[model samples]
Target: MGLLVNDLSVHGQFADLGSFAEAIERLMVIRQISLRFGRTLHCHRSLAHARVTATMTMPQAIQALAFEKRRAFMLWLTQHGPFWEDSRKHGPDDWIECNGSIVTDSAVGEAAWCCLNGIKQSLVSLTPSSWEFSPVPVDWVSNTGDKKSTGVVNHWTPAAIEAALQAEPAPLISWSQLDALAIARCTRLTFAADAFAPLNGLPFVSGAAQRLLFVLETLNRFKSCFDVAGQRTPEGHEIYHDFFTGKKEEGGRGALFSDSSDEEKSKFRSEMTFQHPADNTMSLFCSWHGKVQTPQLRVHFSWPIRADEPVYVVYVGPKITKQ
Candidate 1:
């Protein structure tokens, strides 16, 4: 009854990139979804295209979508898209169609994929189904059991997912990909603020109190470390760099590491080196951090296209350490 593609019935079928594009186009019209304010004048016409133009690549589009909107994209596809329910609409090979390509052929792992070659569908005169997918991420069970989406689609019901959780409401600390962009109407951005609450207020807090805070701090510190006027000691080193994103020094602050669990520090660094080179506003995870962390959370920042939009993200996660 939850999000999973593990039922064997859906084992071989996957929605590739093109299928993703098609579904996104339809969902936009069906749900009256708009990225019109997303990036360009053309967004009023096609949200998918608008996103690609704004980010300049398909992967970037996935990374750039605000967490909620991305959730919408996945929800509408797996739960409510026309072809997902009625196999009749799929191509002869069982793959969903987009510009005559096989979209379902691609591998299905962490995210949803769509195929589109500049197609459009208008829902104004059509009827939609009562069983619709929600605009939130899902965790599913694949054939191997217990597979989690990277929050790429709606409640996956193909038997791959075994549980259900959304980014909305009061969520416990768990691994969510969109943790960085997640929003709460609050006055404090710090983990200890009312929005984050007890987790931050705990008595023994220190060492990157939370993944979100550490992620943000890492970026800020990274920026400061390389700033034009910033200093490099006589030893040709940046202490802030070594402390925030670098390895643990004998005398360094253990507080800089990600302490998902109260007991130990996580090995997860920040993924900035690969994604953001010279770009002032880009974020991701550290290469090693993924191995030791649990209830995963990662946030990537980008240079805002407009003012007052300095830092934004895609939501998802919890910050707990390994056992």
Candidate 2:
């Protein structure tokens, strides 16, 4: 998860040393909470030199902090120092495509740029009045030089940080925690109990579980769209194309899907047929497959004729026979 500290909020916002110290404490707590959930706090490199009050820079403020608070703040800075430095390397233009507008060179604009490009966690701010730094829609300029409103960027004060972290989606499940039952339960995708047996014999490959989950999730989403619309929408096809070409990067892993070649399907008809999960007497030709190329993992499933019926995964393992 990505959390960008609004560095501009740190400068000259505090009323006194006491409030500045309190803000530091809040930041430390936020950092600890983020770490517990496997996230890191990032700030622009300029934060190190940011003024805590009109007269005191961050370093000076740190020195003035109470002993225990100073020690903890220093440690947090030390641990995340490199991340802050890295953030400095990229400018707002790097995110223009995603935001479709020019971000101001100011601190809040930098935070907005980060949020637009997948650093979507809340923008952490020092003072309660950091709301002032929240940019209005009018602040953004479109590529054609027309004013456009960027997506709502969430500005999180110290009080709201914990709740925001708790609301984030659950972490990805590991390969060791993955199984056919888990997949079915997590995705609500239906398949026979024996459909996943092939997975038991396949050697474990790095990122296999993640890749498999992506395929299942994509298939489940497509099923949902079909159920709602009775036909695939352009948006649905765009999603399919992204996964089909391994272009969607946010999901667990890259996947490519295709139908079996006619020659291969003809020769391996028996190998591709499996008992339909919805009906024991009926067998379906499970020729459509999603695959991970490096380790050659394949998941074959049937595309049901009826919109109401779910896709039935019939095989999961090595590639089926092909000439």
Candidate 3:
């Protein structure tokens, strides 16, 4: 995901130069968190030249900072390459229809541009008196004259960005992309180094990767609950059943699944068993699975028994059965 620093958000009064510099520190913290989740931060190409206060441009304000602070800020700017030039190529001027209302606020225009361009905005609010750049909901008209809400240009404060780090990830279009990104993209879950290899030979289905992600997320929630309250909760299978049945909502999402029967598990124990990556100990009889049918796909995983451990995925491929 890309987080664009709203240049408009910085064009306001601050209590002091210190306060403005503090906001820059907050922005840097936000950048660190964003980078942890494989997200990039961006600023408009014109932001460096834009006036942050009545008399100071963004570069001027940075220059006014103490020597060490100025050097650090300059280093960060060079590394992140904040300035983005493609935003103007999208014809941002035509995004918001006038509808007989003259819309002249550059901030609102930029917000509309972000909305149309599928970019998230980060505000540089320095003080309590700073103006809130609220989300702008725009109606987009299709060539057929159908009007539809094209989503709002929502901006995140530093706190909001941190809060959203664990939210459900956006779906990917291919299994290869999902396999490459599953661990980083799914913040709450972990994967075995060999887990994705089996999936490489399998054919891709339209929504199989997304369904697999949902299942993984649900399992992550189950593991989290078990870690916090393992003694009081039911066994792993029972809790897993509740999650898939929608009976439990503590990070649960209803999806399709069933535990392998005792006969099947006994017959295919070797097939179901896998070497644990961390300890190289065998994780036996990973019978719990989430299934996607028609083409028939299955994700086989084991629940964590220890505290602070993640739900471990062992296999993702065609459903294994005794032929």
Better of 1 and 2 by lDDT: 2
A best-first ranking of the candidates according to their TM-score comes to: 2, 3, 1
Scored against the true structure, residue 72 in model 1 reaches a CA lDDT of: 66
TM-score of each: 0.19, 0.51, 0.44
Q: Tens-digit lDDT track for model 3 on 1-323?
A: 34556555566566566777777777778777777776656655555566666777777788767788678666655544655544332233333442333222343344444343233333333333333544444553333343434433334457777676657365355677877766765565556787777777666643456556655655655565553555525655665554454311221222355677788888888898888756675554578887654346677877533555556777877788636
RMSD of each: 20.7, 8.3, 14.1
Put down candidate 1 lDDT per residue, 119-176, tens digits, no spaces: 1111111012221344323333222232223233333231211122222222223322
How many clashing pairs per prediction, in order? Answer: 55, 0, 0
lDDT of 1 at 117: 9
Top TM-score hit = 2
TM-score of 2: 0.51
**Candidate 1 ranges beyond 4 A from true positions:** 1-33, 39-131, 135-323
- Among residues 3 or more apart in sequence or in different chains, the pairs in candidate 2 whose N, CA or C atoms overlap within 3 Å are none
Q: lDDT for model 3, on a 0 to 1 scale?
A: 0.57
Clashing pairs in 3: none
Give candidate 3's total backbone clashes. Answer: 0
